[model samples]
Target: MPAPTEITVHQQSRVLEIAFDDGTRFRIPFELMRIYSPSAEVKGHGPGQEVLQTGKRDVLITALEPIGHYAVRPEFSDGHASGLFSWDYLHKLGSQQDALWRDYEARLAAAGKGRDDAMPGKAGGSCHSH
Candidate 1:
């Protein structure tokens, strides 16, 4: 597989632009990345156990940390920082963004949910604090 030669996170556009060694490049949206996160919190441990992510339309990436030359860990502004996006997975997401986004919208509609529903009312207090 072609490894990523460069990755650019556009905060204004909320997309990550990746360029691979094979001359293939793609721009992936933040919403898509967050919803399809590979972490156990999102993907679950087994097949068919995926948790649908919602209300992440405006999630911002606060930072990016390289992981052992294979993946990048994105720290989201909403406090979610668990998913490690590998090269292969990022490529898949970039290549299939349209279909996946459509499916996500459909799922949200089916579940009577919207982007605003994924988080609590903006009073801004996290239960994760110790």
Candidate 2:
């Protein structure tokens, strides 16, 4: 994976704009990035231990702090800021955005929940109870 040459985040749109030296630019949504975060709270310790993040469709990133030269720490509006997004991971997300997003949507559908279902007062959607 190529390293990102620039990363500009749009707080209002809740999107992260990444530019690679190879001329690739991707606008990744905040919800997508939050769900796919590499943090232990989300990724867990191993396979099958991964936690399905709910109530994040409306989660917006409030801050992004640079971590050294290879990663950025994304602070979300939901109070999750532990995920240190590495360059390789960001690149992978950009490359596999379509498949990942599709899979997420499918999972939500299979669980009988929509993305907005987790947001409490928004559209009067409620969290899915398993």
Candidate 3:
């Protein structure tokens, strides 16, 4: 994986732009990154325990703070700031976004949940259940 030389957050557009030292650039939508967050809250504690994040369609990242040169701590407007996105992880997310997103949508469909139904602070709404 290539190391990011610069990361920029476009608040208005709700996008995170990552540029690597190898001249590769990725522009990831905030909603996509938020939904695929690697945090335990989203990934759960083990396999087959991943929680589906709903109501995040409108979620936007408010801040991106660098943690050394390897990772970034993203702060979402929904008050979620636990996920520390690493360079490799971000790259993976960017690369596999389409498949991941499709999977997420399929999961939601299987669970009878809609993206708009995942409101913040609602119990049994959206969470990791490992």
Choose the strongest candidate by lDDT. 1
Across 1-130, the per-residue lDDT of candidate 3 in tens digits comes to 6899888888878889988877878889888888888888888778877778888877888778889878999999988899999999888887788898899899989989997785446567455333
By TM-score, who's the top model here? 3
Question: TM-score of the candidate numbered 3?
Answer: 0.87
lDDT of 1 by residue, 49-130 (tens): 6667877889989999999989999998888899999999998998888899898888888878886685434445422222
Clashing pairs in 3: 55-118
Cα-based RMSD of the predictions, in order? 4.6, 5.5, 2.8
List candidate 1 stretches off by more than 4 Å. Answer: 120-130
Better of 1 and 3 by lDDT: 1
Query: Candidate 2 regions off by >4 Å?
Result: 119-130
List clashing residue pairs in candidate 2: none
Weakest ten-residue segment in model 3 by summed lDDT: 121-130
Q: How much lDDT does each candidate structure score?
A: 0.86, 0.83, 0.84
User: What's the TM-score of every candidate structure?
Assistant: 0.86, 0.83, 0.87
Task: Kindly give the stretch of ten consecutive residues in candidate 1 with the minimal lDDT sum.
Answer: 121-130
